[model samples]
Target: MKLVIVDDEPLARDRLRRMVAEFPGYEVVAEAGNGDAAIRCVREQLADVILLDLHMPGLDGLQVARTLAELDVPPAVIFVTAHSEHALSAHNSHAAGYLLKPVRRDDLAAALARASRPSRAQVAALAGLDMADTPAYVSARTREGIERVAVGDILYFWADQKYTSVYHLSGELLIEQSLLALQQQLGSAFMRVHRKALVARRHIVGLRIDSRAGPLLSLRHCRCSIPVSRRRLAEVRALLEN
Candidate 1:
């Protein structure tokens, strides 16, 4: 596997490079000091994975990841940051892994082992073939590492402050992407029932009138009800009837 290490600090990059050298079958194809250089190196070297630092001078790691996502064959990103706070943002950016500063060998090994390769859909999209409008899975960072929840299994998405909660068949997870972005990416499979919530059309059981909440959307396999705004109440009802 070819790897690109991106860190503003030369020492940090050297440490990562040395650690990576210890691992067999993986080579450091390139190294960069900033996000722009990182992007350039990845493209030039055709790197398979990137060890990225979050807090750089310009075009932070998150911005770089977003830009890379637009590429026909984007490389897997593994954020190597000191801040734990950006974990949700990293996962939302579809990062393959998140490692704190002073990265451990075991953690780096595990992350590389599970690093995402270009999906078949991505390959098809590059070939100008028909593909799904949205990604097949939404990822979340956990104690066990990155867990991917199938988009089809998602029941709803609720925006809570800075994070958007993804309610799927198994449970719930928080991602940093906004509702508007998700709505745009997910397309017709999800409906904007409220300003703060998006419900899966396939999981909609019905819309029920709530005495206090006015209107609430009931979803299959979900215990809690999602409040529907009065402005969108008619739309939700129409969705249910259809």
Candidate 2:
């Protein structure tokens, strides 16, 4: 697997690179001396995993991991640090593994064996961020990584069997967050037209009645029409006419 080793210390980075090189099948794709550099390197290299050092000059390992989670395709992060006190934070961040400083070869291998994306709680803890902070943006999970979609850009939100798909001006992104939760968090900006869907209040240009499908809601920007349930038809029209 491809790996990026991030450390503020040159010697620490060198030691890690050398040690990782000794391990079979793990290629050292790029190295960064600090969080900013690490973010850039990971974005450029698209490495499979990152050996992240917790304490750094600007953004620490926790901060770096949280930011990286927003990427289109984020890599698995494993914290390698001297501090054992950060064990809880590391776990919350959904890090694949945590290795104490003076990392051993065996431990490194084991950590790599368990690499995975940072969990929602971990990322939130790292940044002291909340999922329902405001109505400006919402988080969506794409195949590659987590993405922040601007509220204005979002056309609608639809719930499928297992996932809630956020349809936006840019495109659609599947998110694990339930549509009800989205409606609650997004507040007045979005209004639900069906039990399974929430349409952007600002995006509704007109309402239509489909002969075959019944009621339909059209958007000024989106080509696709949203099905409006009978219960919500009057309310949808009220908002549209206003």
Top TM-score model:
1
RMSD (Å) of each candidate, 1 decimal? 15.8, 13.3
In candidate 1, clashing pairs total 0
Q: Give the residue spans of candidate 1 off by over 4 A.
A: 123-129, 132-242
TM-score for all models, in order of appearance: 0.52, 0.48
Q: Quick one: best lDDT, which candidate?
A: 1
Candidate 1 C-alpha lDDT tens digits along 1-242: 78999999999999999999998868999999999999999999988799999999999999999988788878888999988999999988878899998899999998886663345444344334445556778888877889888775688999989998998767889888899999887777678989899987766887878787789888866889989999998887786676
What are the lDDT figures for the candidates, one per model? 0.84, 0.82
Q: How many residue pairs clash per model? A: 0, 5
Cα shift from native, residue 153, model 2 (Å): 36
Candidate 2 structure lDDT:
0.82
198: Cα error in model 1, Å: 42
